[model samples]
Target: MAQSTRRRFLLAGAAAAGALVVGWGALPPRQRLNTAVPLALDGGAVALNGWVALAADNTVTVVVPRAEMGQGVHTALPMLVAEELDMPLARVRIAAAPPDKIYANIAAIRDALPFHPDDTGNTQAFARWTLAKVARELGISLTGGSTSVKDAWLPMREAGAAARGMLVAAAARAWGVAPDGIRTADGELFHDASGRRATYGSFAAAAASENPGDAILKEPHAFRLIGRAVPRRDARTRVDGTARFGIDARPEGMVYAALRMAPALGATIAGTNAAGVLRLPGVLSVIDISNAFSWRLAGHDGAPAGVAVVARTFWQAKTAAEAHAIRWDAGPHAELSSDGIHDDLRAALDGTEHHVYFAQGDVADAQAHGRTIDAEYSAPFLAHAAMEPVNCTAQVADGKVRLWLSTQAPSIAIGIAAAVAGVDREQVELHEHLLGGGFGRRLEGDMVAQAVAIARECRGLPVQMIWTREQDLRHDAYRPAAVARLAATLDAAGTIKSWDFIGAGGALTDHFLRRNLGLPGAGPDKTTVEGAYDMQYAIPHQRIAHAAVASAVPLGNWRSVGHSFNAFFKESFIDEVAHAAGKDPVAFRRAMLLGHPRHVAVLDAAVRAAGTPPAGRAHGVALHHSFGAIVAQVAEVSVHDGAIRVHRVVCAIDCGLAVNPGHVAQQMESAVAFGLTAALEGAITVAGGAVQQSNFGDYPVLRMGQVPHVDTVIVLSGEPPEGVGEPGVPPVAPAVANAVFRLTGQRLRSLPLRLA
Candidate 1:
């Protein structure tokens, strides 16, 4: 059977099974009919399924449900699948799987839950409830939150083991030997006593018939590929310029499109001279794309209202768009500026009543007795700035649509395209392409809709809608800027008595509800409140609250999400507390993290790895926990020429078990570059509702000459691997900032620290 048909069969079977279990005579006849239906997978298989097909030529294809955007999921995830299947890594070929609920990420569900491990109910019961609700709402469980590897850690491995089990069973049946007697190694099943052996490819078809067995997964001790350094499977293709990104995809008779969105958010086209633009060479059509905000709330200025230019080539469309004379009616936020936004957020925080996400003991009472220290820190708005600018290719014909794009949320992309094109979800197909980099921008489906619109306008001819670098940077959903106020009380012994954190920022929770979770009007988003509430300190009294301030600028998840700002806030405050107490910064953090061994382990490892710096070198340490992983970084710095020069950085991460040491190291290196860019020169400032910086000239990335030699230490706790991509980001900023503070005796509260 074809892949699509097989996938549908599996989904239908899984849905029926899930419905029987969920509805089980508990509801009335009418209620049972109205209950939410579960999404089914193809091939009549359920419960976290994947397949490995070995062709006669020894080419092994492993299907994955996650998106690959430089996170190395394409490499790391397949390593698990291949190892469990007992196949050589060199023979494995990776394919992105179809969208299905079976692949929905369980970690995002856990993130949405209100119940903590210390909550009243049984932890397992809470987990079950959280996951079921997530499955019902998300429709398709998939990527986001750097949970791809952790979520797939078990299921993908199990699928491989089960496939191996089936192959062994088939081999045993063919050789007329006991299944237990069959031994496998290097893709070959052998029975030394009987002198019978067969390659997996020879038995793949026969293996498809046998019932898959539930073999226990290999322990860490038995792992051959899990902990070892393995080169990325797609590295050769990527480096050789053979891997196709969204911009590289070109269907037959495909045309290109360039769009000029309204300079002001929520503005509409008052008038346009389409008649003049239609005469331009290579210009096929000028489309007035509608602004839809049903999925997300309209910002202060509103949706990205605009016009699109479709042409024979991207440059043609771009040229035509530039030449087109269009007038825009600026919306309500015409006068909005970055300084005005700062004032508005500060005003919001001044409110007496705030939404409290987490509180322990009485912060007000503790604040009254001891000496108190207070400070405010702020971070500027940030853009995703992915290497490959936003682009999506679509072929829409007779109510059938297909999308080729690099998207983190393929299920949502398909659903949005289907809805916009007025077609059944089945008719809308999504082909996952290699993303140059996502950061989080690819999660939005607007580009998918734009491509579909251009395709529909071209009479079913495929259209590859591409955004210019300027358009991509200006029209991006930005990382929200934030302002935080931290107040703490210290006793005479220099111990923290009370901690109160109040922050004001754009609504991350609101965005998550609209974009990913598909929930509307979910109050007081928890993402903005997470890092503050979940601080890994042994404080006697603590309270964390957040207030949301509406802004004209678009805001969404960046690399580390809220933790990026919160780590800067929390860690900087901790350093402040240490300074007030005249204690060593590392010792101060170590004292507060008395109960959390993993946090201490990373801190200890980073410090010891850093060792004693030379006389001129100053050391700074920071520890942060995010995505279920704890990381600590130590930076050694020397100041010269009014610049903070970092000589070396020592990073230690304890993410349970290191799946692939090489991949982990690469992620750390990438994370350092990502975070350093943000720390040194990353900022998206708006003046009069327009992004001020364009391209790398103003918004700079870290250059090779400025980057210090980084040393990484992965501490193995034998715990389950949590996350590697984003956890590495949170610590670097604070570590570097703290090092700067040590060198100059100046407390730098804000990011992109400037030395004067």
Candidate 2:
């Protein structure tokens, strides 16, 4: 009788689980066409949907939901709306979308799932589908992962088409003509049969009442503004010094604040000379901001404790804060050092069994039958080092909080600010500004919370909190330092038979989810093993794994995240394997890429563009696929004065249907410069549980004189647009390292290649 009851319970549980899956899958997709709050309209404009507005002057305004961080997202996204709306790019203006879940970055979160890009199994598909729905409901508005274009591609176009349909229908009703007969072009509706023409503005008000039918999107051939090299919308403002970054935001009667966190990571303030600081010129108040918000993680608090000095002016605040004496009770990780962290990473390789991210075929059998090659590579923790230091302006008054800041994730920022200000989420009003540079740093909402925490003590006065460059670098949630062990077997035919890679690092995704979402991250993280496991090279037997080493140090996303360093590890190892098999690097890569025509095409384009290097320089090639795009780079390099000199770079990308070809080329140049900095000079060392590099004087970027001449070739394709911002970064380090090997006859296995 007990067995029968148990069996009945088991069957009931299975039936309920099956029913839940079916019901969840059958749910409709979240609406992306409306917001809880109406869009702000000017000049008697009418919002057609969540993404578009039409004015009485025939002006079209596109709602750009993503942050503008010099990535050309403002220009690129508007081009999508302008193309589908048949409006001239110049006439279309862009406005920041209000806080809304419709604009959430679903792609970025979906990409965070553990499924490999190459995995097309039913389980992977179901998991992705489920996660996407959940992410939509959760509504994480973010701008990292190069997902701005990819996420907005369909939605923006559909929004434009739907708006146009409404306008056409309005015009058709006004003229008593069929909506199909009324043709739209250049922001005007024309009835060719009756020779009647009307501006879109004439029907803008009436169109608000029309029922917008299913939008018929234009084909690729019909695009006019999307593929063209339109001028960046923010360029003129930035050039004319009219563009307002977070630091430039000046609310009326706003005071300034200077923040100083604990010297050690996650440490707390024990005491401060608060009376002395208040006596300084223009000093208003010194607030204790330790544990300002409940930024909790499992076994750790993600929030850093600090103190803020609020004063009449920024310089006054800065001076007072600098002179204010303080003492800290060092955190639990006081013994932490860069060397110790690296030792832990290396030890993890032997002491712990890593979670396998990807595996196929029998790697053990293939390795046992073939000649083996092994190598290890590592990358140090890196800071974003954006030109503009972290800053946020906040005011707490009338039971509400107002914020003016540059943040990559405003939805997250609003909630954090509300909590810090002791208000509801709906009471927070955010005014997003242009970012001088983001690179992924602004994704964290700590600055917003810190600003609100300081503002709460200002008695309703606005306060602009700014972290000096030293504070910015020292307190950054850094790119996790990683160490990778790679092994492969070469067959008698000089071809790779099997490849295996194991990387150890603080799990970036796990840390990100914990810090941002307050959720415990478990299972294998794809970010830890992406570039190694997701490579396009068709090796038969392969395995990719990650050993997540927990540390007290805070970790966050950098420019390309894992792909930035993993490509260096994976591609440099491939180059080494090619050398061991006595084959040219480019030829070996091509031989391995038999099944991936897209990768092969991009590689060939880069090689063709590179042609032959000048005298005293040698060419080295690297191909990497990331963020749904494939990029290949060929570096023309030579060694001089014990330094690796990369004279030129030829890059090719399959970014798929460029929204703005000129902007795409610009990103490649930007990535090369950024990646070159990391490969040549970037390092963040820690000692006594504190970051050693404080400012650009020590943590320098690549100088303009040292920047390589970059030539970009776009691989024309009909595929949908993928990421254009970060994919170019992954290949640069490996390409330069490989070139150094050929030019100097020495394998520089590590970053910041120094010759002995």
Best by TM-score: 2
Indicate the TM-score of model 2: 0.96
For 669-712, candidate 2 gives per-residue lDDT tens digits of 99999999999999999999899998999999999999999999
* Residue 713, candidate 2: C-alpha displacement in angstroms: 0.3
Among these predicted structures, which one has the highest lDDT?
A: 2
Candidate 1 on 267-310: residue-level lDDT in tens?
67898889988899999999887543344443322236777889
Number of clashes in every candidate structure? 11, 0
Model 1 has how many clashing residue pairs? 11
Cα displacement (angstroms), candidate 2, residue 1, comes to 43
Candidate 1 accuracy as lDDT? 0.77
* Residue 270 C-alpha lDDT in model 1: 90
Full-model lDDT, candidate 2: 0.87
**TM values, all candidates:** 0.91, 0.96
Model 1 lowest lDDT segment of ten: 28-37
